[model samples]
Target: MAKKVKVTDACQGCTLCTMTCPSVFAMNADNLAEAIVAEIPEGEEAAVEEAAANCPAGAIEIE
Candidate 1:
């Protein structure tokens, strides 16, 4: 199945996700990183997973 990505409340406004996957993640007005889209785009699963794994706050969620 396709992967779904989102940022949890634990986000510390870190830009790691954005830096890791600019296409799938971006910083919102609150400075927290959020998923640019609900569903991971084709071939971008690895990048999203990496972002989630690298997130220091463990805010990134991939389901």
Candidate 2:
């Protein structure tokens, strides 16, 4: 099953995740990157992990 990742306080709104994976990350109204996984199809875990790994602020958490 696909898991969900969330953006937290550590986020600096750098948008690195969004650039790395536009399929799963988006810039919210607050200008912070939010991980929207509800629409994510299966077999995309690695991409999510890449986003988490690329997040410089350590704000992305996979649940």
Candidate 3:
């Protein structure tokens, strides 16, 4: 099944998520990373999980 991901308020706008998974995460107007897709595409799950795991602020969440 597809998974959901989010950048929480703890996000630091470090651009890591955007860099790791541009297809699923992006920098919004405020520069904070936001999930571009409601649910992660089947192929993008690994990238999203990597972004979440590597997040320095522990801001990215996946469920």
Judging by TM-score against the true structure, name the best candidate: 3
- Please provide, for model 1 over 1-63, each residue's C-alpha lDDT reduced to its tens digit, 9 standing for 90 to 100: 788999999999879889889999999998888898999999999999998888899988888
Q: What is candidate 2's lDDT per residue for 1-63, written digit by digit as tens?
A: 667678888899998889888888899999998877664557667877888998889998888
TM-score of each: 0.93, 0.82, 0.94
Candidate 1 stretches with Cα past 4 Å from truth are none
lDDT of each: 0.90, 0.82, 0.90
* Residue-level lDDT for 29 in candidate 3: 99
Best by lDDT: 3
lDDT of 3 by residue, 1-63 (tens): 777888899999999889999999899999888988889998888899899999999999898
Output the better candidate (1/2) by TM-score: 1
- Model 2 whole-model lDDT (C-alpha atoms): 0.82
User: Which 10-residue window of candidate 3 scores lowest in summed lDDT?
Assistant: 1-10
Q: Return model 1's CA RMSD, one decimal.
A: 0.8
Error in Å for residue 47 of model 1? 0.6
